[model samples]
Target: MLSHHIQINDHPFHYLGWGDRNDPVILMLHGFPEYSGAWAEVAEDLSRDHHCVAPDQRGYGQSWAPEDVNAYRTGKLVGDMVALIEHLGSRPVMVFGHDWGAAVAYALAISRPDLVSHLIIANGVHPAPFQRALAAGGAQTAASQYIHWLRREGSEEQLAEDDFAKLSSLFGASMDMGWMTPERRAAYLEEWRRPGRMRGMVNWYRASPLRLGQPGEVITDLPEMPTHTLRVRMPHLLIWGERDTALLPEATEGLEDYCDNLTRVTIPNADHWILHQESHRVAAEVRTWLKRL
Candidate 1:
């Protein structure tokens, strides 16, 4: 894997790149606390046919972390993607994201459709369903309780002071017990220990409620953009883990209402961390979908 850094609005963004520059670009965004390395195995296969660019979104890995909570908002996060894509001189690239990264990808597609041609979302529900689920007060709320904890002041100190072992263990336990190798866990611990990085990661949840409270934003409406106004102009593939404990399956029940051209696949026996637990299957499906497109 090749590593590099780019500047977007004065903030340094760290990413991994593979394949030829002339090939079609597929930008991958990883979720909270995960760096671009999470896509290493998948990118290796995809790079054979496409340009794969996986960025460690702001506040994670080697990326810059701003102190302001607003920096972690979806709007700014999507703007960073726009800048990154433009920096690469690629427009309408295929974009794939998991977890919080998926939410950012959805916002990017909706807020700036011209920058994304296709979207592959794994283990995350649409923003509208997510909002409704949060309000309804059930499993979604229960699953998200950790977010509130993270948003509290001094939480990062507590987690970091513990050497990030607890946080690493939480991810491993919640996803796949054996998903994180010692080396990978050590890398995560090192990154989280960076100055202000842990706090920046937590700011994602802190700024989330602001986005959710936006007025005149219809979470249920099909994305409001020229390409998606009438129909989903870009092909969309949704891969979900049937055994996901973080995001309820019911959140995806009415997804078809938002996408005109949607293909849904469920991975049985997989949990929230589908990419880690079933990388080959996920990669194969992504490759097949890209070929069809």
Candidate 2:
């Protein structure tokens, strides 16, 4: 793998690249509290046949982290990827995003389907079903209490306190931590400790328009999703970890309403961090899925 920094939209963006430039492109996107290294293992496994690029993504790792919360909005986030793709060349690319990155990927595909060849969503949600589940007032609503806390001002300070004690705790909050070794932990800590990075990461939650519902209460007057022009027409694959407590299975229900060609896969034992917990298995499944496409 090689590391490089390029200016996109007049901002310095850092990314890890694997394989030759002539190969098929797969732009991997990491979620919250994770940098490009989150895709290290998976990128390595696929680099032999594909050109894999995973960027720090604005607020995490070595990328540019604008202090303004507005910089992390969905449209801007999607624009970054669009600019990255244009910078790479005018070729259609496959996109694989986890967690928050998945949300951005969905938006990118929806906003400009011509740029994305295939959409791969791992343990993430589409806006419609996700918004419904978030406001459903049950276990899902209860599971998402942390969202409110992370959205508060000075929340980054709280996460950065005591050497990121709260941030570290998040990895094991709803999933196993066996995949995160000491070396990996150190790398993640290094990324989190970067000046201004924590605030930028949390800004994603604050800028999001999605809201969580109260448990056992009726949720009304929620903003309606776009009935037209919000559909994902490209072939899409959703690999879900059934054991994920953070984003429960219900969050993905009715997702077909927004996707035209959607294929769903369930990993019974893996949790939210399935990319690491079952690297080879996930990689193999992705390979097979791509072959069928």
TM-scores of the candidates in the order shown: 0.90, 0.98
lDDT of each prediction vs. the true structure? Answer: 0.79, 0.90
Displacement of the residue 10 alpha carbon in candidate 1, Å: 2.0
Task: Indicate the residue-level lDDT of 105 in model 1.
Answer: 85
Off by over 4 Å in 2: none
Candidate 1 residue-wise lDDT, 1-293, digit = tens? 78998788887889999999899999998887687888887788888888999998988888988889988878789888999999999888999989889888888877777888998998976776666665555666566667767778887777776677667655655666577788877777777878888888888888885222222333343333243442344688999988887788876666777776799888997888888888889889998877787
Count backbone overlaps in model 2.
Answer: 0
Off by over 4 Å in 1: 210-232
TM-score of 2: 0.98
In the range 80-144, model 2's lDDT, one tens digit per residue, is 99999998894689999999999998999898888999999899989888888888887789898
Clashes of each: 0, 0
As for candidate 1, its clashing pairs are none
The TM-score that candidate 1 achieves is 0.90
